[model samples]
Target: MELLRNARDAGARNIYVASVLRRRRYRTLTVLDDGQGVDERYATLIFEPGVTTRHLNPTIEAVDPNSPPHGAGLSLYHIRNLAVRSSLLSAASPTSITVTFDTRVLPERSLQSTTRPSRSNLRATVENFARTSRTSAFYYAQPAKILASLIKNHIIHNDESAVELVELAEALGLRISTRTAQKIKNGEIPAIERIDGSGDGGRRRVMTERGGEVDGSTALLDLGDEQMSRIAVILREAAHASYVEVHDLRQSSRPGEITLTARVREPEDEYE
Candidate 1:
């Protein structure tokens, strides 16, 4: 959510948060930023792991991995491929970063709604999705990079197991099905895990350690190639039947297409 906050901080003139591409109901979103560019020579320099220009500023000098520098320096430059944008090449004075994400690939987003949901009110709908934390820095700036990184990097504060896959997906503003839920469980998609350890020993586990993780047997796509191809085939058949199916498919799938799982520590959870 800090990414949302930072977006707001940059006083970003244009905020275009929308679905860029879609897969078998999955979406990959692209967030472009026109904030002041990095040093042309240092365009690629910012993304190197453990690299940050924030240290130059005394206020942000005490840089803990947790206490990230300005959101700019701390986002996922490490996995530029995941973002699939040229950090160096794209980051001219007006820089842009596009993040491609896997939907249903995470638990759900957390809910911290201050107000109750109202069906009669259109304002409620907008407000529900509206950015709540007004001052978190990236609120106005594009959050794709930071948010994708946050979920990918497991940098947020929370207990992974305490949160369910569907719940984490909600936190990220997406959804899934029982089959999808089972995949998250089966795949153990790194960021969040189920609190499934035996006896009382398990209850004491930290949130980060409790959630499931991706393993060798897990298919890269939660739905697997067969299901995805099957869905694609079904869609193709529907499309052959009617052009309306194309619109229906897109409209029904957009929100969930762009999903991100909660970020988890690699190889080990801090809780353990």
Candidate 2:
């Protein structure tokens, strides 16, 4: 959270956060931002306690009298101490910070313990931060998971141009060529019902297994047989989906088309 706040304070317009597992042993968290970056000379010094370049803005302080008078500068210091390994890279513009935790060195408490954070946990963290963030924030996982996050968060809607979608995908480390992005935008490759209310062609509605209806907000993704379990994990974790239903729309009209839908848990629903 402090890392995100630091980026925001640096005047970042776009921030990307990624949680990755390396060799099934190290859990890594990377935060990248397109903001005024730190100078190479001060990169190491910025992580020291009481070291900061920020000053309390008078406008913000006037708005909130309870605001701190100065930056404490302990955020990066604390973050560095908590992680097994951490590094910072900066240039004139974009800056990146990575923190890795070694699973082997961490204490085990449960039989179901895992080395890395679950998809749901990562999604929830990003969603909570995005609720009040002034800048755009993206969370990266697998390619399919990233696409799902983009659509679910309204970062990439059906109306978005193929170029825009491709650019966003590239930022998340998913290299989508212009042709594939165009196909996705046109509902051609990995074809699914269009979400935009264009005409009768886009009139289809998604239904959950419990008979609930999903409106135009439903996210669509194309997946193969082997990718079903991966997508299921994302739906279950990120959306707290009760159940997922798959419909094989493959026919003469749309060859190899498959649609996946899930029931997102409402706020009123009891937690399991």
Candidate 3:
């Protein structure tokens, strides 16, 4: 949350959070933002206690009394100390901060057991952040697949053209190009499948239809069920549709094709 708050404070419009596993034993978390680049001189200093470039805004303070004041810079200090290693690289635009941890390290047991961090925990954190954040945020897993995206609510709820919907789908790593999304919108291509409900929050799955073409014909989303369901809600609202359908293309007899569909329904037919 500190990393995200810092990005927002820096006037960033988009923020990306990514988690990567290396050598099967180490994990790295990266938060990158295309905000005003940090000066090379202060890149390392910003992590020090009581060192900060943020200025408190009266408007923001009025909205959230708990907003940090200027020079209250212990957030990064604590973050760095908790991680095995952390670094800030801001020589150019899109400042990037990375924190790495040794996943093999066992917790020191005390009177009570403690749960180690997992992907689900990360998802929950991001979801909570999305609910309140005003800027666009994206979460990605290793190999550059976007697992989830949080778009501004106004665009999702008010946009009439559905342009933002296509952007949201693309940000979620749906593998749909602008042209393809346009085709889907025009009915030239089949409707895209969407999750029916808040899915069973379980392990990530990469379901692909057998022999599916490697081109744009297939979209392999590696996301938990809850994230998928949240995305479906956004897509449905953006498209002004009642509900979107989720087709299990893996069960189809066709050798190499998959498709998604969405349809309009009566207001009374809406699902809870």
Model 3 clash tally, residue pairs: 6
**CA lDDT of 225 in candidate 3?**
64
Instruction: Report the lDDT tens digits of candidate 1 across residue range 115-155.
Output: 22222222222223243322221211112323333343333
Could you say which candidate leads in lDDT? 2
Candidate 3, residue 69: how far the Cα is off, in Å: 3.5
Residue 12 lDDT, candidate 3, scale 0-100: 68
Q: What is the C-alpha lDDT of each candidate?
A: 0.36, 0.55, 0.51
Candidate 1 lDDT (Cα, 0 to 1)? 0.36
Residue 22, model 1, lDDT: 51
Clashing pairs in 3: 191-260, 191-261, 192-260, 192-261, 193-260, 193-261
Models ranked on lDDT: 2, 3, 1
| Clash counts for all predictions | 41, 0, 6
Model 1 residue runs over 4 Å out of place are 1-13, 57-74, 78-89, 107-272
User: Which candidate leads in TM-score?
Assistant: 2
> How many pairs of residues collide in model 2?
0
Those runs of model 3 whose alpha carbons end farther than 4 Å from true positions after fitting are 56-63, 66-71, 104-119, 146-272
RMSD of each: 21.4, 14.2, 15.9
